[model samples]
Target: MPFWLSWAVWSAPVKKLGARPAISSGCSGVTMLNWLTAQHLVGLPGMPTTVQGVNARAKREGWEAQLRLGRGGGQEYSFAVLPKETQTALLMREVAQQEPAPAQQLQQPGAAQVVNSPKRDAYTESRLNDDQRSVMAARMVLIREIERMSKVVSQQRAIDTLVGLARTGSLSPYLAERAERANDRKNADRALSERTLKRWLADYRKHGEIALAPARRKPNMSVPVWAADFLKHYQRPQKPSAQAAYLAFQREYPGAPSLHAVQRFLAKLSPQAREMGRMGPREAKALLPYNKRLTDHMWPNDVWVADGHKFDAEVINPNSGQIFRPEVTSIIDWATRRIVGFAINVAESTLATLDALHSGISRVGMFRVFYVDNGSGFANDTIREVVERLGGEMTHSLPYNSQARGVIERAHRTIMVRLAKDFDSYIGADMDGEAGNKVHRISRADLKKGSQPRHIPTLNEFYERLAIALDEYNHSPHRGLTKIRDSETGRFRHPSPMEAWRRAEAEGFAALQPSTELSMLLVRPQDLRRTHRGLVRTNGANYFLQDLVPLHGDQVRVAWDYRDASKVAVFTLDGDLIGQAILDGNASDAMPRIVKDQDRRVSGQLAKLVQKGKTLTGKDVELRVIERPAEDDRFQQHLLEAEKFVALAHEPEADALEAPDNEMTRYDRWQQLDSRQRLGEALSDDEARWHASYPNHPDFKSIQRMYDHFEAEQARA
Candidate 1:
């Protein structure tokens, strides 16, 4: 063969002389090589250790000859025509001489390297099975011992000595142990043969340490016919166990294979295919590949994503004083990954979403685009209108695709979920079931008896904690944000969300600042109410103002703070601001009134109304005073005499009144009567009158608290 022809055959698979081939172990190390001079095969087993002797063997074997390409122009024999042992020895020497490139030179941040690269390290070792690693280690030991011996004696003589020691069981302890490990069956106690030791050295030299690993047979990937029936039972949304599915399959197909065989077939299925029917579309997305969202070009306030999360811990509702999980609506900036604003409400609603959005605008000004999922809270007209009014467009992601809003979804876990764990009342999915149940029972019991549990935070306290968490979050370093060089240290690190926002602001980024009046109009919830005369009626209350007079007898939209409905911001049907309206019934209801003032005003009005009623009834005449006459003794005597003829009937004894075991205070007496009335027990006439008067006592509140504590202690006992 020509030298170029031999080189083509040899280098085609490896691509380079020093590179390892991609073929399986059994087919490796069998490539044709370019022609070499007879002098290069001087030390092989079959060829004599002299140029003349190598030439004699080559001539006898009829090896093809080619002209030498470089240096001295002389005859060269084709490497393919050499005996098998000589050929193996030549390839092993060539493999052992190659050097590996350093890993640091090839490894770059976020870059992936090929698995078969010569720079094998711990990462490559992790991919091998324990058995393969053990065998590779043993082969390395043998190769090292050969290299060590070669320094003292000739390389061929060292190999002959080691083979003699192995056959006689006189090798060193470590080498004896390694010889057994190199066997196909690890515990066979088989001594290393001369051929086997040479092959081990050859493989290790070719592919680095990884080449020493024993070859693994390919698994039987062919699926049996019964696999389909087994899979039918296994791949269900209920996610039955393999054992359960096998039993079901056995019932349907009695001739099916054993469970282990079915399992082997299942193991061969790709992960995505195995879960085909075992999960819902939303859940199954976890196994599917996802495209990353790039925010490199986005700026602070460019896009804001909103989502609602139910707080995992229970808190006392401010209005009702009842234990419940508060819903937290979070608005996050996409570029900086900051939680700009959040609001806690009783539940998820459009109003809560709007409140959260308004808060974000107030903090960082209006965002350019409002991005959110297709939830009722974010996909409503009110939220849309608010975003539009703030000079932004509202867009909803595809339904059931919450992954698109990953920033906000991750925030819920990172911020609120972590915040919940700090509280003893946390009932998150990760909380222990017994501990959570105990908390629930204790909290409900205390609340039922009109007491607040210390573990359950009040709404205000929770708001304070949430605020602190958000501030810390905004100031902490975020991995998603771009890294910046620290001015003092001159090292690069991820910038905090707030730091990123400030930097962007310094780079001429300004959020849209809405006017105070417009912000108030946009954030307050709106409702349509009809204006009759000068009053706008809704929520069982009438709102009136002089400005509404022109819009009388027409329907208009009304906006008011949900926290306070006493004052409202009025608007026309065209969304034009009219004027503010006060609650028609009593604006004073919005404020506390002094007891003396209320009493004096009420008494005066009653007197005036009585006088007017008398006049209307025509009974307003005044009588003149006359002198008193002597008492009418005759009528008085007759009354006394008629009393003698009146008959008296016997009265039934009144039921004895039940009393408490201990002496009762005034409040206690009141509670006793109250409990009796609640339980359908009739009170004596005197007791009933006393009970009605007790509520007006000056110590009613303090005394009732004491009595309640006493009752609770008794109940617990």
Candidate 2:
């Protein structure tokens, strides 16, 4: 019989009894043969030919039930009829059984649909310890194994196998091998005891796969106040040790946990928390994940990093003949890791930084960004302006964060620090203390003796060696660079910094050309006064040119190299460069004319004093002779005779001077008379008094010659 037709006729709720009805209680019921006939009456195939076949089919379908005849000698048998709702449910169940499996359904067209479960309002899983998470992971493996096994065998059979394994305290061969490979005991358990399995099954039915995870123990809520206080104090930069914190805690609160407990607590803390407690905030911050700056698409000259490193080795200063550590300011290309420029200075200063930046820009062309640390040399207005003028933006790393400028910092270690190791005077951070001190002492003694130390190289020699090292570094293979074939060698090799730079340039990453005015922008500026002589004096040297005369006495901007003050670039207050000025070596050598005139006046005053002394001495001798009574009359007679002789001598010269015949002579005679009168009057003063005391002085003839020459000049006029 067809399965559906037989099922409908036999399982129908209503049934009719047979005609022989008085022997047994005949409630309306159908026998197996009658049910079969009913199936044929419905135009379907009759039931199985034998009665046994009909009864076997009904029992297999779970529709057979035994019922007793009421008050009868024996019981009658009939199939229990299903209700209408039961029939419909069974029909639906049969239809579902014929449907394809879930995996098979996914392979069919239009079978994919989003299935959304109710969103959880609270956390689905709490934080788990490492051990708990590991245990949960192992249990999850077992659950997946069961699920996979159920596809090939009955679920009951799979459960029975797992239960048998758990009773014998053994695991599946696959799980045992995995546990041995992993060296984890927890993963070796792939089965559960019957009781445990039953509990797991109940949990799975309630909460799905999540219930397979191990439950965590409740956290201790009654933490002592002292423990909290200790944690707070321990994480400080001073970083008290756990024992020290525990000791302190005991003093503050006697009810705190024991030292062993505290130690255990610390051991279980998160790595970041432990680092914070023992190391410092800086170390703790390092534990956190940070976004890495990506430069994959960056080209050479896109960014440049600059920093100043105090060279570890002492070098001789050429100008001063002294040994000192020099600061090396360097600029590196971000993409190629190549050193583009560097400069050495006695200290880290704006001029030094500018020199490095200028060298880089001039050699490689302009860049787009300039990265630097927040150093006084780099964070100034001048550097900022110079960077902007070079068509780049200047960015400063966070304070005390050298990692941000790590390219140049690492370059210092890789190049300069390594170079310093070859020198005996290296005072590197890792140098042995006694040796460094001894070397330093010897160098100091040499300086005191006015001699150069053999251990140190001169500045020029240092620069020469540094250049070699830098060249080697730039051409060396770098891990950051991509591998490429060498064009000349025709062999595979890692790309060098210079090779990378060339490639970038060829690929349209060409650098911008800098202007001629770019260098002037990098120099240090000073407000200086220009002398009236067109000279500007700085550092005891006068810088000037003929063109600067117009700016004399005006306060103008003077830009010059601090290390070389022999020349300066002169600029107006409005930033116009007038001209360059050379040092005037003799600017301070010349004296003013007024000083010479003062020297002449002082010499004349000394001469007059000497003449006055002589006059006074002669007068004293004459007075002594006149004071003697015996010689008084004789002296008087002698003075009168001398006066008469002087008068006669003067009369003839005066008459000769007055003698004039023509108009010019008449004028000369008048001038001679006027000069004689004026001369007589001048002789009555101090000069004449000194001369009159010594009338026979040798200077008298020269004086008379001076007056005669004056008369002759007047006669000609």
RMSD of every candidate to native, in Å, equals: 23.2, 35.2
- Give the TM-score of each candidate: 0.56, 0.56
Query: How far does residue 557 in candidate 2 sit from its true spot (Å)?
Result: 3.1
After superposition, which runs of candidate 2 have C-alpha atoms over 4 Å from their true positions?
1-193, 197-224, 271-284, 481-494, 521-526, 549-551, 574-577, 585-717
**Cα lDDT computed for each candidate against the true fold:** 0.69, 0.59
| Tens-digit lDDT track of model 2 for 1-717 | 784354333222222332222222121111121111212222112345555554564455433223333444222222113333322332222322332222211211111111111111113333335764565566566556667878999767777877676557587677644333322334545335554445556555555554444433232211222334457555656777778777775666555556776676565444554555466545555765566566678988888999999998998766566678999999999999888888788888888987787667656777899898888889999888878866789998887577677667778888989999988999878999999899888888876765556577767667657867877788778766778987767998888787888888788886776654655455454556656568887766777678777766788777776644557777888888787777883366466546578878977776777678778786422112133445334345444544443332221211223322222333344444456657675323433332333233212332444468679978987
Q: Residue 621 in model 1: shift from native, Å?
A: 48
Candidate 1 lowest-lDDT run of ten? 645-654
lDDT of 2: 0.59
Q: List clashing residue pairs in candidate 1.
A: none
